[model samples]
Target: MDGKKVILAEPRGFCAGVRRAISMVEQALDYYGPPVYVRKEIVHNHHVIRALEGRGAIFTSSENDVPEGAVCVFSAHGVSPEVRGNARGRDLRVLDATCPLVSKVHQEAQRFARAGRTILLVGHADHEEVEGTLGEAPASTIVVESVEDARALDLPPDADVAYLTQTTLSLDETAAIIGTLRERFPALAGPATDDICYASQNRQNAVKALAARSDLVLVVGSANSSNSVRMVEVARNAGTASHLVSNVEDVDVGWLDGTTAIGVSAGASTPEFLVDQLVDRLVELGYDGLEIEETATENITFTFRPVWQTEEVVQP
Candidate 1:
């Protein structure tokens, strides 16, 4: 493994949305002091959660878990209108940390519904984001997870249809599904812009590039992370063996058999340290040489600091 080269994919991990969400939690902690309640893991990275927890952030599954008047934040995945209402009803200090990209999807769903078009959502049924988007207009919106679901869909004969997709989806697969939907419903209206966010698309594109050049591709992201899962699928789709491992510990030495060049990338929620640790582990396994394949450059940044931090302006 000493002479083997490890190809790292650029434009991986901690997209603008994830960065904003995590910063929201940290800013809440800094501004309001600890015990700031978060509705869910701000991002999917365990290390990020643990770090925030250490700073007095409380992660819970529901608004009820937060005390009255407690500062509560919605996770990056976004929440349903009902959830937002429940938080408001509970008198919680709500600071939404939903990724703007996801919020855009929600808005699109509402727009289509308002226009009298039946909305089709391309995503897993049970995912939190999907649940939230469906809640926007459950009566008018339908969830289509695959081409099979698209084919089997039953809708009003005279209904106009529009489609919106989850931000973190396999680009190639989603395109196929979207193509099928367009074929079946020639007049189906899609989002004014691409539903898949730039970060997700760029990461998938990076993985595709890495997979084509490497013998094995290792994606660093939690199993439940949609973008991470799609990265693995993207690599496999490119004819390379791939695996989705959450962290360094999840790597099995046996997977490295006969592998020369190993490609590494991470989900948007994943942190850079995790990728670094994975590279270290790979080095330990004898893949010492390192190279980076820069597929795209990301310069996007989001800034929304808590009120307290903004007030502490000191003139130089």
Candidate 2:
């Protein structure tokens, strides 16, 4: 393993959305004291959830779990209107931390429903963001999980339809599925801009590039992170071995036994510190030389706005 080098990819971790979501929790804790109830993991990263838990953030699967009049923050994945209604019923001081990009998608869903168009939402049906978006027009929305699902649609050929995609999905795969849908539905409309988040797209592109020359590529992100898993898939599709890891502890030393070169990339929700630790561990394993593969530069930042910017505004 001696003298082996590792290539890190640019724009690998902490997209603006995740950064803004994490900051909302931390800032809520700072301004409102301990016991800030956050509904669901603020982002997909467990390490991030644990860190915030240590800082006095309480995570609950449902907003109904929060006590009356307590502070509750929605996750970055956004929430269904039913969840928001539940929060209101509980009289919790809600601080919605949903990513603005996600919010934009939600607005589009509502607009399409108003126009009486059946929606073809492209994503994993069970993801929270998908669930939330589906709630916008449950009667009018259809979940498109794969090309097979797109083909199995029972709607009429001339039906009015609009297509919206999940923020974190395999770009190539999604494109292929959309192509199938386009062939089947001539009047299909799409979002004004691409729905795949910029961070997700950049990270996946970098992983594809890294996989081209590296013997093995390690992606640092939790299993639940969609973008992270997609990055690994992209690498594998590029004809290289790839693994999804949460941190340095998850990196198996054996993968490097005979490897001369390695590639590392992270999901948007992953913290840079995790990548730093992975690099350090790789160094210890004899893959010392490091180079950052410049694929893209990200300078985006999101500013958060609470439902009500006060420590004690009880109703929302």
Candidate 3:
């Protein structure tokens, strides 16, 4: 196609929470020296994890792997109370990096549980965030991944229930599931605020806007990043072809064969450098024209806890 263009979505890549989380790890490495232990994938992006690892951050799936009294930073996805307890028992010097948004969801779960309501958590069950949220009140929480799952809930219509969502879910999809719950349980309770994170909502809306005018959409993020996958889904649901591009090498030339306008966006946890690389590759392939699709302006920033900047350990 002649004069093919790249339409980049505004407010894409490295949301405030991600920036805070990554910065905490880097700061820890600098202050605590090499081999600062981190639980989980930090923020679900391998590139970020690898970069931190190169700088002496050690990632482990379990807190037990961290040596006693070593510095350990929690991932942005957050951890369950049990995980926190385990870390404490090890006497690990902890630095919490959980995104404030996800922490809100966890608080909602605990509050609902305290009220003796059966909490219905909506999102992919296998996701790290979902797993951690579920652990908040495992005995009283049910994981609902889809509207179909909501429909199949075995609870009575009048059962006491409250629903919370994984922060990084597709806004439309989460709404549908919540709608289903409301229809089934007239007395269902929910968070005073929307559980979906602002970054996710903004990125999804931007992707839909991009899908409206582009021949194809490419979301830059790791495969495991829920928000990035949701952006791709948002574009496809808007009737545009979309794919998740982990990096420039993942782009298939055939997808761009006749595409005149390709939309580009990155997940919340993605770094802008990946987007730059993808854009550079697209330019080399002759899609040099560039336009920005500004659906939203994100000026939010998250600050690290006081303990993250000091030598004192943060009690879990």
Candidate 4:
């Protein structure tokens, strides 16, 4: 299409949590040399993982895979108490890089369980963050995956219950699920603040706005990234065609056949460099005009206590 443009979404890519998690790995590599063990993909982005792997970061699915007494960093998605215990048992020098927002949900789960309330956790059950939160009080926690799950709950109407959500879920969908819970459970309690992370919320909102103006929207993120997938869903729900592009190679040329304006956004865990690559490809594909759609400005940053700053927890 002649004079076609790309409308880039602001507040897209690299949230504070992802930044902090990645920084932890990079710093660990710098300070500890090669073979810094990272449990899981640091932030759901394969490119990030690959880059770190190139620089001597070893990604493992479990802390148990790491050598005893070696440096091991937990992913941004977080690990359960059981994982932490296992790390301690292995005598691993643990550097927890879980996002603070996610850590908040874990704390809530523990609190609800301590109060003897059955927890109804919202969001995808299979996600690492959900798994970690569930681990907080597995006996007392039940995962509610959808509005249907919330409606199908068989808990007694007067049962003491509390609700918590994974930090990366879609705002609208989570609201619908929570609404169903509120209707079914009159005594249900929840976090005073919303559990969805600010970065996830902001990116989704920006994508929604971008979808309204573009003929197609492409989100740059890995396939397993929850927030990236949700952003694609949000755009589709907004009545626009959308796709999740893991990199420049994933963008389909045919989707632009009749499109005039393309909306581009990235998941929170994604790096802006990936978006830049996509934009470059778009420019080469005759969609040369470019404009930025600024929906929100994000200035949040997360800092963490380094592993060296903490006492070693070697197995006795």
Residue 303 in candidate 3 has what lDDT?
82
Minimum summed lDDT over a 10-residue window in model 4 is located at 307-316
lDDT of 3 by residue, 1-316 (tens): 6789999999899999999999888888887799899999899898998999999999998999999989988989988999988987888888888899999999999999999999999999898899899999999999999999999999999999999999999999999999999999999999999989999999999999999999999999999999999999999999999999899999999999779999999999999999999999999999999999999988899886555554335555
- The CA lDDT at 209 in model 3 is 95
lDDT for predicted candidate 4 compared with the true structure: 0.92
Given candidate 4, what's the lDDT at residue 239? Answer: 97
Query: Stretches of candidate 1 above 4 Å error?
Result: 156-158, 305-316
* Total backbone collisions, model 4: 0
Model 2 segments more than 4 A misplaced: 1-3, 306-316
The whole-model C-alpha lDDT of candidate 3 against the native structure comes to 0.92
In model 3, the runs with Cα more than 4 Å from the true position are 306-316
lDDT of 1 by residue, 1-316 (tens): 3469899999899999999999888888888898899997788778788889999999999988999777888899989888977987778778888898999999999999899989999998978889889999999989999999988888644459999999988888899899989878888998999989999999999999999899999999988788999999999989999999988999988999999899999999998999999999888888989999999999998777554433221222
In order, candidate lDDTs are: 0.89, 0.91, 0.92, 0.92
Between candidates 1 and 3, the one scoring higher on lDDT is 3
TM of each candidate vs. truth: 0.95, 0.96, 0.97, 0.98
Ranking by lDDT: 3, 4, 2, 1
Candidate 1 clashing pairs, residues 3+ apart or interchain: 1-286
Candidate 2: tens digits of C-alpha lDDT, residues 1-316: 3569999998689999998989888888888899999998899999999999999999999998999899998999999889988887888888888899999999999999999999999999989999999999999999999999999999888989999999999999999999999999998999999999898899999999899879999999999998899999999999998999998988888887678989999999999999999999988888889988998989999885653463324653
